[model samples]
Target chain A: MTATAPQALATLPLADDALILSHRLGEWAGHAPVLEEEMALANIALDLLGQARALYAGLAEVLGGEDEIAFLREERAFRNCQLVEQPNGDFAHTMVRQLFFSAYQQPLYARLSPVLPLAAKAASETAYHRDHAEQWTLRLGDGTEESHARTQRAADALWRYTGELFQPVEGLDVAWQELAEEWHADIRDVFGRAGLTVPEGPSEGAWSAGAGRQGLHTEPFGRLLAEMQHLHRSHPGATW
Target chain B: MVTGSAPAGRHPREASLTQLAGSVPDPELPVITLAELGVLRRVAEPEPGHVRVELTPTYTGCPAIEAMAADIERVLREEGGAERVEVRTVLSPPWSSDDISEEGRRKLAEHGVAPPRAGARRAGPVLVGLSPTRHTHPAQAPAPEPVRCPNCGSAATELLSRFSSTACKALRRCTDCREPFDHFKEV
Candidate 1:
């Protein structure tokens, strides 16, 4: 089996999701609003990176190498959801995004755990991620007027991008409709408590924004790739 | 869980190798050995002079894993006189705080860190768990035991943050003792 194998190709989307979101979270290293939050986000990023590493390691037999697959892939080759690749607009925006993704990941991993060892292992970590995101979402959405507005705006802005998460990828045999409904119910439950509105956009119907799983991404994904791949590209064999 | 156990008593060579590998102190918490932490899953001499060890991580992204692997290799090569050492990490049946030995729990409490509650985690797939404050279905799951204050042995502890100095720990404050400490929370 090589990189061209269908099984290997199926792996790209899952690995890319963790890796890209991890990079986005790492961008907050020294820039987080407070020390506690800084630690929290970094911890989450580390967890996701660990997952990405494990998934990539499994692919090492099928793919040439983890580094080659991750570092050398062009923009169109990545298969993460567009939602994860979106830039961190604000703290509220980041939290909203985290909430959306973690909510999806928890159930997805739980359902996949029976078949994939990696997925089983990641389910535990995903629980904490969802908790972290939900906590922040509640505080931000129900706080001061500005925070309320910001959180709500972030939710509405990221809503369209979330449909891609439930869209079926070729290799994964998941109950897509069930997963989507669960995700929706989760969002509504959390948003209701936080005093936030569920965005009116069509989440699963045609015209909702998505397609990162198909190697089609939004504009910012290219820049994200440049920054992420720059060091690995420049120092091909550099080791810490 | 048993990979290669025969009908006879354990092999003496394999036992010693397990001890040697398990003796390595955890990279983050020096108070506990890998064996005490229960992350040192297994060690076997599969072939002459070839040592293979399976180590699990408390958290998937625990940075200490690489360090732990390196340390295990160093010990097996220099101390155990192994010509080749290969440390492999295993993730199935993912490491849980319940994996920590009783000795490990005592050490953590003595050092003012609360040990995870035994059996707080059930086997099989499930969420890692959330604070009781914001859980979606509070009535469905039994209430978790209160985290005792390590300093005063009081149950009057409250969560300050779900995350703390390390990923495995949660920041907690003891209302009784007015002391903030880390709870080695259950996974």
Candidate 2:
């Protein structure tokens, strides 16, 4: 392996995070609350999938083919954050999840933008995603008592997994503390405006209950992987 | 590297090949040529009769890229009389709405998709805090510039949705004519 091999390996989890989330969001096609929303979610899913493809393609030289890495990998071999792999529970849950993840992604991409051109492009896309999630969070949180309660619950439930997003990856050069702080401040501000409270708990520190960077995942990930890989695995060497 | 092929001795046919490849219309937005859309990054002949074209997708997951690449290759081989065509996708210096040529913008407006507003590039520090923090300060997002209605040419419009039919557009409604239209969102 070349010296840059580890750097390519580091990108796998980031790519997987996007890939899995794209699949989850894609599941909402034709199932979103409205036609516009359906289009919106699918568009977002497509963007994530695009980012994943680019990242995977960048690693092609080091990791063989992008398809082989994305489709053929076993559950234990896949690297992705637990947050993205969590099931999309409801509209509220999905929106909350999107808000948290996009908020983290926006800043993370911004920091990486200088060194990685893909990050610059992904940063722009993530800006829209973060805005979409924040808008929904506000609408849902302040709209109705039922909506507010549901979104609030979703926010609280998903907070734990967010810490993992701030964890340092091997190749990425980021100030984890600053990223975590910015993420926290952004989430707090959005939640505050939406009439929701930021869930206070253990900060995203060394002791966080996540090893997704090391290939460990939550319970729901295996099923998600199965569905994602089923078609690709079944039709090996198939061309469209 | 072939020693015979020198930079100063580039074949005259190479320029025509570049022009031919660049003239291919984007599969999705037929109104704009690949050159206008800035998707056609570079066209070169590494050796005689072998064309290499580089392209960047407008959006990360734009499905049209495969078709666009195929179209480029087909055109070069069948029409341009090239022996081989290679199309590459480059992500660095990622494509921006700003990359849309003046002609592309005009064509997009003519086609009823509002082109991105000039000088509306999303650059600068994004302030995420509602309250001032040590690293950042409270700042509201910049308001979107007025997108003139592609149909009626009215600036009175309201954003209905941040996303539209395609990944590159946002849904907006013209207040004057009451027509919902697509605004080519600034990336």
Give each model's whole-structure lDDT.
0.83, 0.80
Name the weakest run of 10 consecutive residues (lDDT summed) in model 1 chain B: B132-141
Give one digit per residue, the lDDT tens place, for model 1 in A1-240. Answer: 111223545666888899999999999999998777788888899889989988888888766687888889899888899999999999999999999999998888788776666777798888878977887888888888999999999999999998889888787777888999999999999999999999998765577878888898999999999999999999998778
Q: Where does candidate 2 clash, by residue pair?
A: none
Model 2 segments beyond 4 Å from truth? A1-6, A203-208, B1-12, B122-140
Candidate 1, residues B9-128: lDDT per residue as tens digits?
778788777888888988899898898898888788989899999999888889999999999999999989899999988998788787888888999999999998877567332223
- In Å, residue A190's CA in model 1 sits off its true spot by 0.9
Best by lDDT: 1
Looking at model 1, the pairs that clash are none
Interface RMSD of each: 3.9, 7.1
TM-score of chain A considered alone, across all candidate predictions: 0.95, 0.94
- Candidate 1 root-mean-square deviation in Å: 4.0
Estimate, for each residue in A79-100, the C-alpha lDDT of model 2 and write its tens digit. Answer: 7888898899999999999999
Give the top-scoring candidate (DockQ): 1
Worst 10 residues of 2 chain B by lDDT: B129-138
